[model samples]
Target: MTAPAPSEKALVPFVSVENMMRLVHHIGIERVLTELTDVIEADFRRWELFDKTPRVASHSREGVIELMPTSDGEIYSFKYVNGHPKNMAEGLQTVTAFGLLADVSTGYPVLLTEMTLLTALRTAATSAMAARHLAPKGATTMAMIGNGAQAEFQALAMKAVLGITHVRLFDIDPKATEKTRRNLEGSGLTVMACETSQAAIEGAQIITTCTADKQYATILTDNMVGAGVHINAIGGDCPGKTELHRDILSRAETFVEYPPQTRIEGEIQQMAPDYPVTELWQVVTGQAAGRRDEKQITLFDSVGFAIEDFSALRYVRDRVRGTAFFQSVDLIADPDDPRDLFGMLQRAKD
Candidate 1:
């Protein structure tokens, strides 16, 4: 028997991270990650169809803030995130974020989500998705530099996407490394604690950097990297924060999420104006070559693009519909008469 659909007058649900977490947990992390990758890849292949722009950024003495916006004619989305590295010491998240999805036809918001957790998930998913194409075949071991909030997501994504079984971990703070290890205790992967970045990258086929600092700091030097290592540079996403040495970028073939934004935010920002690089979407769409040779060193210069958040928002919206958890507030005024904009105010007086 077919059930009747709910009418438009039916109240909509609003979801928080706690509610969304149940959805995520029930679906399993790998499945969610796979779906997100599929959506992002599909969107990237039709890059010309999107209304894209560089994110709007506001700078402060403590940190930098940003709003990443994008649309595909039907749905428009934006994420508000702040990058304050010093916040952790004060017991706050280094990067706290939230986002919205709107209907372009009317500029009506359809979904609102706390992106703090989703950002970590999507960032890791995007990295693994890019690595699927750019990294060398049969890549197993990964060295995670800068263990923090993003460390577990990175480890889980690599394990789910690339079949990684061994992870070498390192961070300036010992507690952070311990926390990462604790988070992945039952995730079915071997975790090794390393003393230095050199030891961490020691035979690792994949290297992920996710440090939270607001300066041009080089965590990985040219000498530490070996042939066929896929470097996922996630921390050096802003102008001043960098993980790889400039000389390392000189020797390796680098791929970026979006060329223009990455040019200003990725590690390549340290390089010359004409430094050659390929966009990951090109490789995803088979328009460019990836890992040309087994001996070639590759880097994925990640700057947390808007398209990723778009994908994440879409996923959350679809999953939350009819779930009775999401609460929808009246953000738009719908008057009975098209020309009665002033009538809405008069009704409140009654």
Candidate 2:
């Protein structure tokens, strides 16, 4: 039932929504993204050290809920995230998440935190970080194909990580593009609202597609993509969902976070079972190549892997160490005697 006075080991540090925002403001959003990229990159560099598995999922007619778990030899982490493309229309976030980080040595949770905004941040950081390795040299402009909840975050992240100063935005809804434009005003980046995806990518060397839909929709066709440009496709994250046409995938050298998971949930789902794709970790660790030539096309088919979330938790653990942006909660059941479970329950009756 109830435990007596708890020790520090029984408490879990929690970062609430307000505290998460405060942390972002404290570190500055772009700066936080840059830092997160570093953290994620570090984890990727030692990719062989991680225990990797595909996220477990429970699907519903309305949406899908997933549990992404991973652990290194020293630390363990997992996240509970949901994807409901229709949530915004119901006055909710399209995606919401929370996660826990545990010490592998003791199997006790060390951190519990909100990851709804954090997911958006990590996804953007992951994309921009990949671009640093995959994008063509001297790339400065980006074409954002979907201007929704993730549009602005993707924009600023590319700026922070890649020094991209110009963003050309397009959306099926003009209002969404306007919202992104209004949000980015005076952010020291030139933001352009465009009427078409083709116009958006006119001079952009990096094209980012982040539309939220649960279907195999082609936001960018093969002809739309030119040589030497890096395409960051962030929206096609689940089964039956993809953004790039198959022709584009065939022509470009695709890099993914995890080949097994991406084959099921990323754009590669549309490709043949034997279709070749390199893991992004390989490219990052120099085990494989990134961009080979100025005329080579590079595509990062991102589907939000567990290792990235684990790394995000790692970053949070480091950032909130001495900061006031978290609260402590008694999460573990701490009894006077480890084996006296019934005794602990009986003592609460008094």
Candidate 3:
């Protein structure tokens, strides 16, 4: 006779990439971004309740692979992600990821899902959340310096969350800029394909740099950044990688997610060990200031953090419930008796 089916407790919910895409389309991308921003911001407000740590990374000349983990007493989560700048040259994704959520009490996974697209959404939402507090008032029109997989998401997040009405796109590869413009054709925001980074930033209040280079390079020089503009630098996320010139960091009042991690991987890695930077959580909780004055240069040196991933996973776990977006995977083995592990294996052999 065939073995009995696994118990409900032995199964875990899994969301495939296709299901994730369907879920996003089902809820609408802009609404998903807006809701994710709110969820992330809510977590930031209670940041002290979560256990945080820097991501463990394995670096190579070709790329970097990392494991980001965090817990909020009740639930535990971790994401396995990789960043390979050279992958694009080989027709592969520059980044890819998957994450899991588990119950802290039993240490058993409850949800597992692909994070490549989820990460893009969470990254954009986090940038918009930081900008909500830091960007200059009445800001519209953001310059997207790198029009790659993430460019359109960033533009749409700013529009949905901050009400930005226009986006200027630029890339060293004109085809990439054209791709972004084409994807955003009906996005309800004026999209301009710019000739240069300088042209992209002209008449734009917010400038976002998201290039994929594994070495030290200056995407934006000090002179290119005028006063009072908000710079969202997301490309520099590893030790040897950086996007903004060193002098620009000095001019802008920089903010970050976590000091320990940012000191090692973010644009601030170029600065001194004791570089004065405010934590974004402090700004979210009103303990510190954000965008203190109209003419102040505000820089959000975002180096994707684990808590944000945890927040995103938490959001997905909640949203996928009672929906067909996830399938149950028989991941655990439950024995008929607690101590019948050998008997269970023998019985399955029949």
Shift in Å, residue 2, candidate 3: 2.7
Give candidate 3 regions above 4 Å deviation.
none
lDDT of 2 by residue, 83-167 (tens): 9988989899989999999999999999999999899999999998899999998889999999988998999999998999999
Stretches of candidate 2 above 4 Å error? 1-3
Write model 3 residue lDDT over 1-350, tens digit each, in one string. 67778888889999999999999999999999999999999999999998989999998878899999999999999999999989999999999999999999998899999999999999999999999999998898999999999998999999999999999999999999999999999999999999999999998899999998888999999989998999999885998889999899998999999999999999999999998999999999999999999889999999999999999999999999999999999888878696987888888889
| Whole-model lDDT per candidate | 0.85, 0.93, 0.94
Report residue 204 deviation for candidate 3 (angstroms). 0.9
| Candidate 1 lowest-lDDT run of ten | 3-12
lDDT for each residue of candidate 1 in 1-350, tens digit (9 for 90 to 100): 33233234222345677877787787898787777777777887877778879999998888879999999999999999998888989999889898998889978678888889889889989988988997888988999999999999998888888889999999999988999988889989999999998899988999999997888887988888888889999984688778888988988999988889998888988888789999888888899998898999999999989999998998888877767657765545665665975775566556
TM values, all candidates: 0.94, 0.97, 0.98
Q: What is the full ranking by TM-score, best candidate first?
A: 3, 2, 1
Provide the lowest-lDDT 10-residue window in model 3: 1-10
Tell me which of candidates 1 and 2 scores higher on TM-score.
2
Each prediction's total of clashing residue pairs, residues at least 3 apart in sequence or on different chains, is 5, 0, 0
* Of candidates 2 and 1, the better by lDDT: 2
Cα error, candidate 3, residue 134 (Å): 0.3
